[model samples]
Target: MFIRIVKMSFHEEKIPLFLDNFHSVKNDIRNFPGNNFLELYQDKNNPSIFFTYSVWNEESDLETYRNSDLFKSVWAYTKAFFNDKPQAWSVDKLESLP
Candidate 1:
C-alpha cells in the first residue's frame, strides 16, 4: 500500500472557506480510482494547521489521481487559502501491530 500525508496551513480568516471546499470535494477524492482510504486531521494547538492522510493501491495510482481534473480543481480552490507552502510525504508500511 502507498500512504500519503500532506500538511497544510491555511490563513485563519480563510479556514471556513477551506472547510467548505473540502466538504464538497472529499467524497470525490475518496472515490477516486485506486484510493483505499482518506482522512483529515487538525492540530490541537494550531487550528489553522490541517493534515490529510490517504492510502492508495500504488504510487502510480496516486500520480494518476493527482493529474486528474478533480485534483486540479480541488487543489486550485484549496491552495488559495494556504498560509504556507504544503508539505507531503509518500511512504510504505513496514509492519502493523495487529
Candidate 2:
C-alpha cells in the first residue's frame, strides 16, 4: 500500500468552516474505491496547520480520486481558505507492527 500525506495551512478564521466541511464528506472519501484508510491531524503549536493521512491500494487510485467530482468540489471549497500553498507526498509503507 501507499500512503498519501497532505499538509494544509488555513486562515485562522476559516478553520471551523473547513472542519465542518471535512466532517460532512470524510466518510465518502474513506469509502472511495481503493482507499484503505483516512485520518486528519492538527499541529499542536500551530492551530491553523493540519495534515491529512490516507492509504491507497495504488497510485492510480489516488489519481482517480483527484480527478473525481467529489475531489474537485471539496478541494475548491477547501482551497479558498488556504493561508499558503498546500503540500503533499506519496510514499510506500516500509513496515508496520501490530
Candidate 3:
C-alpha cells in the first residue's frame, strides 16, 4: 500500500471558502481509480492547518489519479488557498507488529 500525508494551510479569513472547495475536491478524489481510502483532519495546534491522509493501492494508482482531470481541477482551486507549497510524500511500512 502507499500513503500520503498532505498538509495545507489556508488564509485564515478564507477558510470557509477553502472548505467549500475542499468538499468538492474530496468528492472528486473519492471516486478516482485505485483509491483505497481518504481522510481529512484539522491540526489541533493550528486550526488553519489541514491534513489529508490517504491510502492508495500502489504508486501508479496515485500517479494515475494525479494525472486525471479530477486532480487538475482540484489542484487548480486548491493551490489558490495554499499558504505554502503543500507537503506530500509516498510512504510504505518498514515493519509492523500486530
Each model's Cα RMSD: 0.8, 0.6, 1.8
lDDT of candidate 1 over 1-98, digit per residue (tens): 99999999999999999998899899999999999999999999999999999999999999999999999999998999998999999989999897
Instruction: In angstroms, give how far residue 40 of model 2 lies from its true place.
Output: 0.3
Clashes of 1: 0
Better of 1 and 2 by lDDT: 2
Clashing pairs in 1: none
- How accurate locally is residue 85 in candidate 3, as Cα lDDT from 0 to 100? 74
TM-score on alpha carbons, each prediction: 0.96, 0.98, 0.88
Cα shift from native, residue 44, model 3 (Å): 0.6
How much lDDT does each candidate structure score?
0.96, 0.97, 0.84
Residue 18 C-alpha lDDT in model 1: 92
Candidate 2: clashing pairs of residues: none
Deviation from native of the Cα of residue 91 in model 3, angstroms: 1.2
Please, what are the lDDT tens digits per residue for candidate 2 over residues 1-98? 87999999999999999999999999999999999999999999999999999999999999999999999999999999999999999988888899
RMSD of 3: 1.8
Give the TM-score ranking, best first.
2, 1, 3
Query: Candidate 3's residue-wise lDDT over 1-98, tens digit each?
Result: 88888889888887888888778678668767888889999999998899898888888999999898888877887788777778887789688799
Rank list by lDDT: 2, 1, 3
